[model samples]
Target: MFSRRTVLTGMAAGLFAPYFHDVYAQSSALPARLVLVLECNGVYPRALLSTGTRAALGGRANTSDRLFWDAYKDTPLVREGDNLASAISLGPLAESAGKIDLVNRSAVLLGLSNLIAGGGHSSGTGGLSCAVNGAGATVDAVIAPRLRRGAPFDVLRLGTSSARVSIVYETCALGPRKPAGIIVNPSLAFDSTFGSLLGGSTNGRDRKMLFDFALADSRKALAEFKGNSNERLKLERYVSSLESLRTREDQLTGMADRVRPYLPVAPKDNPLLTGAGSPPDSLKWFEAQFQIATAALLGGLTNTVVLATGTSGFDVAYGPDVSDVARHNLQHGLDAGQNWEKVAEVTRRHVQLVANLARTLAATPEVGASGSMLDHTAIIFMSDNGEQHHSTSREWPKLVVGGNALGLKTDGRTVVYPKYDAPRNRQVSNLFNTLGHAFGDADFNTFGQEGSTRIAPGPLSELYG
Candidate 1:
């Protein structure tokens, strides 16, 4: 007969023994991954649509009429016009258009209003995660625990800007108002967040020493809190968070070991990229982060990630000849011919980011899986507002990519909702709830009040296989 202490020790070892090996072949099915790419301000809807009168003059004025002018009624927005064939198009994403059935793989929910009654960037942030009324969890937070289970690095919030207001959430409804721990200084040590298990580059023996130290410290901390009632609860949560971090560190170390041999060593003069003056470098770093995030997901290190492209009123100079206008101002110039061209350029840049992520996922072979990592992950790309000036959420430019292997049809079909008055439109919460349902939360209906009251029923069924 086994003693209780021996039995418990055996159970613990059984749970963690898999960490000793790559464990990629342990499961045949890859875990579901969710990534949300959020662009500050809003997307220029006109850049997404090619219908209605393209005349430079004032053709029609009704906001409702503007909604129907887009190609959602007859064809996917990508096929609407010739100018958009190359400009403001999904670019390389065109490859994914027919391979996955749009009608079966994805759904576009247009005309959904952001019920939040405030104005400007903060409100957009609030509306993007929590509903307009500030009464629901961000979709990323809601689905994180469910999808990854005990995996480390459940949700990573990353941003390019130093402004805390842009990257962190103020609303409590979005999930406990925990500080996001934003990585503003690119030079900041990754060790601070992922050091213990992976170790730092000081000494040859430091790796094993650090891991042993972390384990001892964790055990001591647990033992100290065993007697204190209130302290025990706090320690429990701390242990939980730390354990998750430990798993992440282990997986990251394993992946780094595997990929480091194939990667070029960092150049001595590789200054950390920062600031608006370095758009090209900024774009490169952004792409690098996306690659890192994809690698983490493929390695089972994390299941959810939120990436912010630019913050509200983000003012980055393109060049001396180009307009140095901010994102919001540039978006407001949608009706102007030159402004539309600029908008198309910006939209193209955004699409390029998506393309980079998609390509990375497509390239990574899933462990113990037949398809690529891209086939198992669902990516939602959206902006806070549909257009620059309108502020209304009607005819919002949103896209859902990947997740085909997890029962999503991604052929790029556009689904337009019946026109409604601005107030009665589907709330952005609908998208949040729909995402939750996709991750296997069957009870995930009615996010915000406006979402429950106004949005169409349940998840958008058109995208599911």
Candidate 2:
């Protein structure tokens, strides 16, 4: 039949086909891991560049219109041998002497654009899928199954919202029209991940019942559907979402024994666990999700994970720091009182959280590897949209930590591709292709919409060569 599932599968195989032999032909060494951390709206490029790097690019030091225009130029991270100069967003990663101790193990990427994603308000599924809006399988979906050695789950998708939503499905997808869910409620996420070990929690059991019923209903409805193509597409997406949840639940049950030993303790003093009858802000949820993700990675539950905050129409009002302006207003580059620092504060907080996760991984040793877990893992931090709140899909800034085991040349390096207007400029799809190459797919060059004449083909040789 001409169903969406078959079409999507075929398209994926054609667009970003994975070679089974190459993906599986790896030595006995432990597989490299991936953790993608994404924030919502947009990230100002200036917030991420160090003073010296900006100066080197002749960028004005202030946040005025002149400085905003200067951000489009090629600006690299200021480096001294093996150390990077401090940027406000990365200041938390620095030591007491104000030196970034993690510079030698990190890399900063700039000037890559994603016009194909159609950025505004948010990129939705396009952020990870690299396809417009909600089309195509996201990078996580394409890479997770290939990289998952023996993990119970294919990918761990956790998220935090400004609101008290239980789940949001804006940033990930399995295939065309198949959106992946981000568990926004920490309490529910904990129950989903670890609850089965203790015979399952009440919430988990109740939620499972609802999920099963919905899945059954969707399948029945799909079978009965003799509607138009648009209606059929909607039904297919709904069924796909339910099926994805069921698959995760089944995996959790089957892998309970394997996942039990590495279970992380439930978040302590978490507001979500306080029975407050309301969800806490993104700050509290971000910390909880991080704790859960660390456990999932270290425990061998999953080698690929995605942690999100303030994405997909979720809450962006972090605290009094941002003046509770939410995402739309904050994207204006001003709070209610014209406080630009508030915007920088939110961006810095995201970077701070990412840095802490990197430090934690660096501190722990890989169970079957010679170096620390960080050496074998890649932690990527980026904004869902491009630069600024109302993003123009130009000059996306990215930061990556570790992944030395995965052939990443991120040792205190700052790679700034040409601006989007330049003929030789690179796209985000190239970066994704580079990651696919790092994860053992040697010939995996065509990712996302790179087949288009507008985009260049192949992985970024500057990153992995």
Candidate 3:
């Protein structure tokens, strides 16, 4: 009877042989990286439509207008032009306040539907996983290991909620019945990722000591147990998990010198994060999480990250202008009685933050490559729900930036597929499949849950170079 530890060891050494080899023998050139930014309450579809696109669709203002949906029902609309910057929601990404020009490297995707995800206010993990009620591994988790380059973390999940929750598991997942955790507290996230660089905090030391004690105890049990019973198998699995965790910790601790140069200025604690009933500082948390993710990417700590905000079950009060308004109310189109300007501002803030990330990455040189870090990375901003609050999962829009090195044809393009009811309509799973292909997973065409909603197999060929 083989022990669980032995099985895991063999799998790591043999099943993932090529990945392990790449980790130790990677070349100076940087591998492709991915960043996914997901937000709740859906994106206002009209906000993404530029003047030219609006004109092409017969100058429709209301996206819900039957005429608007019919305009692109039979034929898809694909345009790459100078008018992308004119879109209200895309202005910040096109030309940030900091003057970074990402428009040429960006693409706006529209008309993709995902009914299998069961969208309403939010799709829970379904938005990324493309499984009903988040019943499978998300795209981030699926691709992280394949793209891994010996980073301490293959994928880092970070998020901020309207509530004072420290962590959440509603977004990404590892596999079926396995949900991943997103660090909601910035301080805790920093302590976990960069704490070792600052000589290790008391909490870190205590955790390490506990791990050591558990490992010692487990080894003693392994020595004493003579039979390969179910109990012993469980013990072996537990020990293997502990050992893997310890190895990861040791790797992070050994990289102090390498991580120090890229460390972010640690976030100062805010009083608003104290009480359970106190409103969360949404803006502050967003900024801190973005900074930490960027630092982690630059320091070679993680290659894939999911930065989420107001996902399902998270009704965070937004930043300054809309701080007083209930996020849920805004989602219902009730910000100061039927005006959506506040909602637009909230969406714009998320875009501006993404723009800042793109800008910083564009200015920084790749660690072991010729061009800037932004050139080798793919950044995606998407709505967790579909096109509107209480969505019917009819249309989903995405804003994609960078990834020139990964064969993505994102050169100021605007792609509007046929309507959801159209026979040729595609789903969000196709996008994930496309990304899987871009990451060099050539045969990763069937990515998510399949049913009648699936238009066809394979990646969106139009997205690739």
For all predicted structures, in order, the TM-scores are: 0.70, 0.78, 0.87
Q: Could you say which candidate leads in lDDT?
A: 3
**lDDT over C-alpha atoms for residue 241 of model 2:** 65
Q: Give the worst 10-residue stretch by lDDT in candidate 3.
A: 10-19
In model 3, how large is the Cα lDDT of residue 376? 83
RMSD of each: 9.7, 9.1, 8.2
The global C-alpha lDDT for each of the candidates, from Candidate 1 onward, is 0.49, 0.68, 0.71
lDDT of 3 by residue, 1-465 (tens): 222222222110000000111122222134778999987768867767777877776635435332256667466678876467677777786654557788888888888888888878878878888888768888887887776777767677887876456777777777787777877777777665555455546755766888899999999999899886998898887888788777877886677555555454444533333322246656656766777677666666778888888753557865454556667766665445644776666777888888877876777666565677778889998888778778887888888888877788878888888888898888899999888878877787888896756788778866775
Off by over 4 Å in 3: 1-30, 59-67, 96-98, 199-207, 222-233, 261-265, 269-277, 335-338
Clash counts per candidate, in order, are 10, 2, 1
Clashing residue pairs, backbone N/CA/C < 3 A, model 1: 100-411, 101-411, 102-411, 102-412, 104-409, 105-409, 105-410, 106-409, 111-395, 116-132
Give the winner by TM-score. 3
Q: Residue 315 of model 2: what lDDT? A: 46
CA lDDT of 297 in candidate 3? 67
Evaluated at residue 114, the lDDT of candidate 2 is 85
| Candidate 1 residue spans exceeding 4 A from truth | 1-30, 50-87, 95-109, 117-119, 132-135, 162-176, 179-256, 262-282, 316-323, 328-337, 420-425, 449-452
Q: Which tens-of-lDDT digit does each residue in 1-465 have in candidate 2?
A: 122222222110000011111133332246688899987777777666766665555545354441244444443333433334366576665665633367777877777888888888688887787778877888887888676886556677877766546777788887888787877767677654555455556755776788899998999999999999999998997787677666666766676555554444454545534532233556656766776776666556677888888766644555554456665666564644655677777767777777776776676677666787788888888878777677877767888788988888878766666678767678888889898888888777888863454567678777777
Ranking by lDDT: 3, 2, 1
